[model samples]
Target chain A: MDDATLVALARSGDGDAFGQLVTRYRRAAFLVALSVIGRPEDAEDAAQEAFLVALERLDDCRRPSRFGGWLMTIVRNRSNNLVRREALRATEQIPFSARSSTPTPEKEAQLSELRDEIARALGELPEVQRQIVLLHDLEGWKHREIAQRLGLPAGTVRSHLHYARKSLRKLLKPGE
Target chain B: MVDNGSIPLELLDPGNSDPGHWARFQARVMALAGPELARRRATRPLTVGEVLASWWRLLVPASVVAAAAMASLLMPAETTPGAGIAIEEALVAGVDDEPLPAVLVADQVDEVAFLVAIEGGG
Candidate 1:
């Protein structure tokens, strides 16, 4: 079902409908939070908190059709708050076994290393670039969709994405 | 800008690699939000008809009392008991045939003389 239909059903207290919404937007929410907070664990926490907040303030959502954008805003705000609260903290290393569920230990280690490397590279980019790259490439959102949701011009989103990818490539391949 | 399909950015997304993780995340959110959703359902806004239906008991008696009061106010004053008697008394008093009696006039003079004596003493 579309976001509007799901939102209406959820408003009527359909737990399953809300669960579907959570499932649908969980990845995007996580990516958005990660872009802001720069930590997977904290990003997950922020996303979870954002979902609960959205549930509480669902009635205040004036436009049910644009639920994704509203939820993204909540995720971004919550992530930023988390960042501000822990400004002096150091970045925690991503645990290989904790985040990876590959069939083999060797593949798990490799995937974890790649994830960490990409995350580090992403961290070096500007916040908007991180958001645009993750939403566009990782989350597979169209450029126009990202522009509309982020309230930026389509050309700006494309420019940011181009620069973000270029930076990531350079950061990842400095030896080359 | 055409996206470079070669970046393998999907490696950074754990949700796709580990479905169980995302499942747990969704389950956790639903568990935490269940109570709030129930509250929303419980406190949903009532429709106009529902509001009227719920308040009919109080509204019915109040409407009856209001209607009775309006009817009483609109009724002609002649229907009331002693109303005609009061009008007749006023008309008779306006054009009475009797002259003042000597004893009653003497009583009035005595009251005025007593008040004047009290004021003089004070």
Candidate 2:
């Protein structure tokens, strides 16, 4: 079923529909939280909190069809709030895990290097650019979908994506 | 379509949120959701500040009306014929202005007598 239909059902107290919606958006929500909070456990907490909040305020959603973006906004807000509240305690780290017990040497080396450089670059990005980059590159969200979710124009999403990728490429250059 | 493939998709998805993790997360969320949903259904309790704010609205108008009533009760009586005359004004005001008309002379005497009775009583 479409998001609008599921959202409507959820608003009428359908727990199953809400569950389905949560399943569909949980990954995107996690990525959004991770982008802001920079820890897997904290990101999970923020994402779960966002879902709970979304469920409670489902009726306040003005556009149900854009539920993914709406949920992402909540995730981002919650994540940012968590970060602000724990700013002194938050240790800077890659947004995702880098360690793997077993992997080929070359692939592991590449992953290690990428994790370090990318984390620093991503941390340096403006929140909007980081969000657009993560949604587009990490989550495979299309520009139009991202635009709708972020309430930005498609052209702006594309422009931000281009600039973000360019910045990442420069920052991730070898031997820097 | 920006293809920087350093990060693997397998690392980001399909495995990070394993079924067990998803199940637990879902359960936790649903559990918290129960109270949140109930709280939304419940009426919000008003804070003391809010109660006082509402009372202030009613109190302001009621106080205004009460003050106006008190002021009216305490206002010196207008010195009209029907209104009770000011004692000082009756005793000394306009004493030399004119002689009373024949029809009003008796009434004037009665008013003067009443005023004298009040003064004596006081």
Best by DockQ: 1
Please, what are the lDDT tens digits per residue for candidate 2 over residues B2-120?
14535333344423535587777778887777765555445555669989999999999999999999999999786557567787577767687443343246745576666666686
Recovered fraction of real interface contacts per model: 0.58, 0.18
- Tens digits of per-residue lDDT, candidate 2, A1-176, equal 99999998777666678889988888788877867876667788999999988988888899999899889889989998888778656665334343334455886577555554566676667778877888888878999998999889999999998888778777666655
Pick out the ten consecutive residues of candidate 1 chain A with the lowest summed lDDT.
Answer: A93-102
What lDDT does each candidate get? 0.81, 0.74
Count of steric clashes across candidates, in order: 0, 0
Error of 2 at B46 (Å): 28
Off by over 4 Å in 2: A88-113, B1-20, B35-122
Local accuracy of candidate 1 as per-residue lDDT tens digits, B7-89? 66777676657779888888889889989889877877777998889899788999999999999999987665664667546
Candidate 2 structure, TM-score to reference:
0.60
Candidate with the greatest TM-score versus the true structure: 1
